[model samples]
Target: MTRGVGSMQDTFEKVIKHDELFHEEVLPRLKKLEEVQEEFRVEIGKITASQTSLELTVMKDGQQTRDLLGRFVDHYFGTDDKKLVLKEKVTLKQLSLRAKIALGFIGVLGGSGGILAGVAAVIEILKN
Candidate 1:
């Protein structure tokens, strides 16, 4: 019974030492770490809010520019007499043939060699 009592006392002293070390050493560092984490979180929130505000401003400006350009086009170019007039009347059969030719041309241009050639042709045309 005395040996058991001595063991209990030893264990109690060890636990007291550990509790003192935890309170003196670990607790303050843990509190500091928590404070730093809170600061980082606040900074991230500020950066995200700034980015969202900038994106909203850019979207509003783009919408305003698009509305202004659309109004200008309606004022200047919205007339029946300003419409394009084809030289020949296109029949349904001719339209179908033209569509087929266009599809074939697009298919050819989809190939790598054809894409290079088409780019070269466009560059030449632009140069001219």
Candidate 2:
């Protein structure tokens, strides 16, 4: 009975030493692994934020490109709300030479028009 009791006490002592070894050796390693995992989680969060910002920048650049293309088309083809000539680009500009020519023609014909009207009136009076 004393031998059996000594064997049981030896087993209990071994269990306590194993528990102490586990606490001294394994627990610090587990704590360091937990810290490394937390660091990895923080790095992953930073990468996610960077990826989201890059996506937004890409989207903004795409929208700006579309807007520039629209403006280019509008500048070349004119807007939707106005008349346009296809064969020739027309910008309305008045020439003083054309105005001078029109004035000369008016001055040359104005006296003849009044004289012809007066002659018609005279002929009607003679007829009466």
Candidate 3:
């Protein structure tokens, strides 16, 4: 009975020693590991924020590029609105030059011929 009691006491002491060793050795290491894990989590959060900002920048740049391309096409290819404005300017300049040339030619016609030529030229322009 004494031997059996001594064996049980030895086993119980070993378990207590193991528990104490784990508390003394493993607990601090685990706490340090948790701190390191928290640092990694913080780093991951920062990386995520940076990635989000970069994505937004890329999206904005892409939108700007598209807008620039649209403007370039409108300028070069002449969208309908722009084409109408350009056509009006050209027509006005041509009409002014034609009127001047016709008046000069009528000057050469002389007297009543000049007046008749002027009227005819005006009528022709209006008809077109």
Candidate 4:
């Protein structure tokens, strides 16, 4: 019985640690990617509406050039990959949460008595 309890504790710790990591690393990256996508969409719309067909130029250190969309595409897509990465991270987070909830429910249901008894046992454990 102690061994089973130990295993459960270990698994719970692992899940909580992973949740923290995901919240720190993945969520921020997703937010940045979303911002970049919105900016890119706005720029594309402006570029498309410009009637002159003037070559888009970027000026840096007194140097001006064309190929604005190409450069922007590279930077934008590079950042947007974070969106895909975030989707995978979110799926993992959701799966972990679901598993934790299911484990708690199972612990209640399968522990020899019904819901009230399971709650009592949990309360008793907490009191200790």
Indicate the residue-level lDDT of 39 in model 3. Answer: 100
* Candidate 3 clashing pairs, residues 3+ apart or interchain: none
List, residue by residue over 4-84, the lDDT tens digit for candidate 1.
655987898989999999999999999999999999999999999999999999999999999999988887765533442
Cα lDDT, all candidates: 0.73, 0.72, 0.82, 0.70
Q: lDDT of candidate 1?
A: 0.73
Total backbone clashes of candidate 4, pairs 3 or more residues apart or in separate chains: 0
* Candidate 2 local distance difference test against the native: 0.72
Model 3, residue 54: what's the lDDT? 100
Per-residue lDDT of model 3, residues 1-128, tens digit only: 46565598889898999999999999999999999999999999999999999999999999999999999987787777788899977875677647755764665476757766677666657766
Residue 123: error of model 4 in Å? Answer: 99
Q: Which candidate number has the best lDDT? A: 3
> Which candidate do you rate higher for lDDT, 3 or 4?
3
For model 4, the local distance difference test gives: 0.70
**TM-score (C-alpha) between model 2 and the true structure:** 0.56
Candidate 2 residue lDDT tens string, 65-122: 9999999998766753345542223332232444444544554567857555455445
What lDDT does candidate 1 reach at residue 60? 100
